[model samples]
Structures are given as structure tokens and as C-alpha cells.
Target: MHHALAFLALSQLKGFGPARLNLLLQQCEPDGDDFYADCLRYLPQIPGLNAQQVQLCCQRIHNPFHGEWKERDQLLHWLAYDQHQVLTLGHADYPELLQQIADPPLMLYLAGNAELLHQPQLAIVGSRKPTIEGFNDARRFAGALSELGWCITSGLAEGIDAAAHQGCLQANGKTLAVLGTGIDRVYPRSNQPLYEQIYYQGLLISEFPLGTAPRGHNFPKRNRIVAGLSVGVLVVEAALKSGSLISARLACESGREVFAIPGSIHQAQYKGCHQLIKQGAKLTETIQDIHEELAHWLQLPESYSSSSFGLTTDSSHFSSNGLLSAKDSLPAVGAFSTAKNQQAVASNQSLELFTGHSHSADPSSSNMASTPDAYNPNLTAVAIKQKAPSVPKFDNPQQEQLWQAIAQGAGNLDALVMATGFNTGEISQNLLMLELSGRVVQEAGIYRVNLSV
Candidate 1:
């Protein structure tokens, strides 16, 4: 919370950017595996920290953020209100994918289902201006995927993205809406209904401070969240340089999968999808294509072997782009995926960390390595199908702690550990065993007892 307030104060300043703030953080924030906030005695020198900018903003001349308790307290008040909360990367509550982003939001303001941020998410994105076919394509894809229990994620824009959310909801699936504006302000005005529904059904998340307006620049930053939260981002319809294309780029940069639906050869709308396919984005014509991709990805043998990709077994290294690398050479992080696309009036922006389920997937698919029931297909979303009452089974001390924590209303892993007085390692093992038994379900980052338990 302290760091969140400090970040907000810096964000409110006019000249600060990710680069400059990163400099400040490296010098002043927590070090190594420890990530916590402490009071600053003086403003540390950020290579490009602007003195004039601080002065203009009424910050202390030498100690720009010194003793800014009143302002911090005000931010605390906002956090305490309904539809207001904040989370940061590296913390237990923060989304794991956001940590993989090139430039992530330091402090995000979340308006709903703060828990969903920790769940698994998929990003569905496309051009704001799309053809009628694009809209149908987006909705159908989202609905099919949601029916399989995937959380639909998207920027709450007017066209393809909006349709994606509607489809997810119709499938009784969960969705997340990420925004360029503050959590309280719905941009474009036309998406207000979707926005409200997401607030009630899934979640609405943002990096912009409370009451921040939707300016022209925030969308680019918003795109990062759209791409960052998902296992992958799917482009429904886009121009070569459309905002949705930016999301695909961001997804690539973050090492997430990029999928594109092919459009008609004669249509201008298909150009971007075709371009992406040619450039190596996965060609996604059906949900099964995605499922197969995930299944293949999960089936990778732990032992790295280039022969799996048709490369010579004697190969010592891979192409500069890693296309021919040994299977084990692929970074461990690229294994998971996000199934993007859900058509609804709303798109969920919530991101959260999952300690237990992060390594698992729905059992119905062979792609999931950990176990069949290790995770909920809609783990990252809040599917409103009456939130089926779950009963968790506990065969170990760790599993027992997980249930104890939930029974006490501790909604996150950290809280569960604190409440159970157990180390994360032991607790996680217990949770994993419980999940594999299908007695428990992991959502976002929290664990709950499934009805079978």
C-alpha cells in the first residue's frame, strides 16, 4: 500500500515515465527477492529526475515526496471505498503476466473482483472499427472458448473487443476488462453497460489513478494490460497498425502466444491477420486450433531436444529467434497460454497471481501437465453460474490450511499462509495435491473446495 501511494504520487507528476521511475525504484525500492515499501528520507537521484518538474508540481525541492502523508492518506481513503483498490507487481495480489510485461503498471486501480486479477486470463483484441463479420467472428470465438471455461479478457472498445465480452457472458463464462482510463470512468460512453456488467460480474482494472481521464496516450498503456494479463492475445480484425496490432506486438514482447483469425482475401480487414500469420503468429481458424496448440505445448518433454522440432539432435544452439532451439531451451515461462476473445458489453482487466493453479490446467485437455483438475478453465474469471458451492478435500496439512484460510475468508495465498502459519512451499504442495484430487479448485490465486471435496 505504501508503494502504491508513492507510485500514484509519481504518476500524478507530469514528467515521470517508466524509465525514470524505474531508475528511482532501483535506487530506492526494495532489493532482490524482498519487495516491500519503506519511508524515504530524501529523494534519491534518478538519472533524469526533473527538479523543475517537481517544483512546478509543488513537490519538496530536495525531498520531492518527503512526508507526503496527507496525500498518501487520501489515496488510502480511495482504496477503502467501494469499487476502488490497488495492487502492484511482485506482490502476491499482482498478476503474474504483468511481471513479464516490458513496461507494466506500477500500481493498478481495480474496481471489481480484485481476486480475478490473479486468475488465468486470455486477451481478445481487434480494431475499433471492424466489419460486421469481424464482430461475429469475435463473439463466436469468445463464446466457444468461454464454454470451455476460459476467462475472456479484452479492452472494452466498441467493436470486436466489446463483442468478445458479450459472448463470454452468454456462455456463462467470466471476463475481465482492462481500461486506459481510471476504474471509475468508462471511456467511449457507449460501453457503459458492458462496463457496469463487468464491474458486477467479473472485474475492471486500470493503472491510471482514480478519476484519471481517458486521454489519447493511455490506450497504448492499456494495451499492455490487455496483452499482459492473458496467456495469449488473439487478433480478430485489425489494420496493420491498428491498436489491436499493438496488443499482438506487446504479447510477443512479453513472450505470450499471438493468434490471428484469417479474414477474406478480398477484404481490407483481413490484411492485418494475414500479415501476422505470414510473420509467424498462429493461424487460428477454430477453437480446436488453439486447444491443439496448447495441448502440444503442454506435452513438451521436460528434457530439451531439438529433434522434436525436426532439428538435428546434435544442434547445440538455436536460431537467433529460438525457432530451432531445443525444447528445454525454451524459457519455462512460455508454457502457459491465455485464450483470448469473449463478446460481451464488458471486458475484464483484472490480473492476479496464482501460486497453486499457475502450473496446471483443466483436466479435459491433454495439454495440461500438472494434472487434470489442477485449475478451473475459468480460473481467472468469476463465472456467475451461481458460483457453484464447492467443498474442498484435505488429505494433507497443506490442503487443510488452504481450506482453513478460505473458510476464514482469506482470499489470497499470502493471507492463507499467514492465517495457517505455514510456509508457502508446504502450503502450495498441499494445495497442488488437493487440486489434483479434484477436491479443490484454484481460481486467480486463491484456492477453494470444489463440490467433490
Candidate 2:
């Protein structure tokens, strides 16, 4: 049988989960055409498969197209439709990032642009019933980031999720919805229109069977996929027990960046965000705040680099390893290269603002928070000097160290990694923050001290 059919049959096995299925799949040759036959032949030898499970697999292999999998006809029908596909775990198109997760789905049912799975994605997740302000914040962030070439990924729930998808749509940018229900189903019937739009303009993805209805337990699995597929996750507004926090936790576990927008302490809905901020998720206020952290990790699209908002710096100074070298000096991107020149630029030229969230909390609110040794997301520049030894006039010793490193010609990720003994993620986050704040400049991939700063 075909690999997808084999995976579908194996998935229907009563007790087999992703872990055991993955273990079994590992033993089968990925390139083989008759994967079901291989699974049946190797069933007894596969560890953790009890006799009953082995017999069931053998029976299914003997009758690959037997009356098992009531949803098989639906799956086949969906697969035959335009732009519909099923990506098995071992499929080349299966997302590498999702595969890295602890328990990846054995298969993903996808609609719309399957190729989009490979693009840079940022997940925006939050409460199902959000305040108007929170809803607007979701839209605003999603729109801004979408214009910058990010594919916004979110669970297709109400409130924040809907707003995010709408925002991306408004920007005429790509957005993806990971469904808690099946790929063929749209929950909350209210979003049926939005679902149609995404099906044509973006992508719809799910790991559940074709007819799986929305269930409370199914969402956490959906949440994991949303978190797994993105390079970072932004929590707009969530209560203490919100599933958005779950996504943020999973993102943290996956080592992806987590950003939380802070709201008033009195607002119960924002407590989750505050809790996340306290737990080392970056305190995000502006799009620049997100950009400050994620810019280094993402390859900005050509439109972003050439857009009015981009800095046009020389690319020739880039080293063979894709990092900038310190040997050559290049002109800064646009007039913002210098602090004085930045003042001359029109105020309208400034980055867009999402005003629903504020930064009123004292930086010291993180007193109970544990600092991650590499990058402390909640640690502000002001608190850095207080937390660490004073480095002359520099307010942030980490930034100061990074600046000195760049000044000394350690210009790339690898160079900084070797020079400061910090990991790539730490260096990337810090360097991007410095660049966004105008204290440092990057030409091509190389980093340098902004003499004007």
C-alpha cells in the first residue's frame, strides 16, 4: 500500500499513539513503496508492540483497504481535491521544525499552499473571548508582521485567533490556521467565512481525522502544532489558565522565542501575560519590540529589505560564513544610521504602534522571576546595570559587551559565539535588540558599533 495509506491504517490502530507509531515507522525503510507490508512484516520485531497490537497491524496489512478507517473515503476524497494533501511523518514535505517536537503528529492534513509550511512563521495565540482592545491588538500585530513577510500562524478560534487571521488578510499577506477540529471542518461556525478565505488565500492544517469535531482535548494537540511550526509565539492577552499560556510554555520547551504583551494589573485577562513576562517571555509593546528580538533569526524577505521601512546597507562586507566581518565599514541603512539623522526623519516614518498593551509595570516586577543565563527576556536595559557590574557608562552590560565585540571586529553570529561564549540564540536576540534600539548597526550580516549612539 502507499505510504500515506499505510500511515492512515497504522493511525487507526486502537492503542497506537505518535510515539509508538513513530518508533514503528523508524524501523521501516522510508523509501519503500509498500510501507504497510513492511510494517506487518516487522511488527513482531518492533519493541513495545504487544501481541494484540501486532496481530491488529498484521490483519490491517493483510487487508490494507479493508473496512477499517471509517474516514478513509473522506480522506481519499479530500486528497483528490485541488490543493489538498496529507503529509506523513516521513514525507519530505513534513515540516522539519514540527518533527523536532517531542511527539509530532504522525500525519498532517493540509489545505491551501502546502509549500508555505517551509516559510518563516510567527504564532499569535490568545483567549477565545477577548476584549475589543485585545482583539484589536491581535489584528494590529498580525497585520504589521504579515507586511514584513511573516506567515501568521494561529488556532482558528474566536476572538484573538480570528482577529489575527483578519489582520493578516487585511494586509494582503499570508496567514495559516491550525485547526482544533479536522482539516475539513471549521469550528465556531461563525468563522466559516474566514475559513473559506484562508482555504483559498492561506493554508489550513490539522492532524486529526477528516471528520474530527472540535473538542476540548483536541485543542492542546492543535496548540502544540501551532507552537511547533513557528520560530516564535506572541501571546496577546490571556487569563491565567488560558491555552495561550500553554502554547507559550510549549514554545519555551521547543526553544522558540516567546513574547507577551503586558496589560494593566487590574485586568484579569492580562494576568497570564504578566505571568509569562515574569517567567522570562519578552515584554512586547511595539512591533519593533518583536522585531528587536526576531529580526536576527528570520531572513527578511526581499520586499522587507527593499521596502520604505528597511535600511539599505551594503551586503559586500558579509563573510563567507554568512556573518558580517569587522574589516570593512559600510554606510548605514537610510538616515536612521545616526541619532541626529533619525530625528530629521518624519515622525510618520516611525514604526506602527499597537497601543492596547502598556509597559507600566516596574522592571523590578520580575523579582520572583528566574533569569535564564543566556537571554533574560524580562530583564530590561535599565535593570541590567543594577543586576550586573557597571560597565562604565553603558546601561546594559550585555549590550555593552556585544557592542565592544562588534567594535573589536567580532561581527557575525559565529564570531560572537566564539568571542563571548554565548550561544547563537542569545547573541542573535541581543544583537537584534541593539540594532532595533539604534545603538548598533548591521551592514549585510556584519554588526558594528553605531558611532552616533
Please give the distance, in angstroms, between residue 193's alpha carbon in candidate 2 and its true position after superposition: 0.4
lDDT values for all models: 0.62, 0.70
Candidate 1 per-residue lDDT, tens place, 1-453, comes to: 545644555666665676765665655543323232221323334445576655433343224356654655666777787867777644566787787777777777787777777666778998776764566567657865664446889988877778787667654678999898877788877577778878878888888766788898889889988998888888989887788888898899888889999878887778898999998899875554565554343333455332222223333433342222222222222332332222111112111111111221222333323323333433322221224445444566567657655543343344455567778688777777776886666543334555434
Backbone steric clashes in candidate 1, count: 32
Q: Which stretches in model 1 have alpha-carbon errors above 4 Å?
A: 29-42, 52-77, 295-453
RMSD of each: 17.1, 18.7
- Of candidate 1, the 10-residue stretch with the lowest lDDT total is 345-354
**Candidate 1, residue 189: CA error in Å?**
1.1
Task: Name the runs in model 2 displaced over 4 angstroms.
Answer: 46-53, 66-69, 301-453
Which candidate gets the maximum lDDT versus the true structure? 2
lDDT of 1 at 265: 87
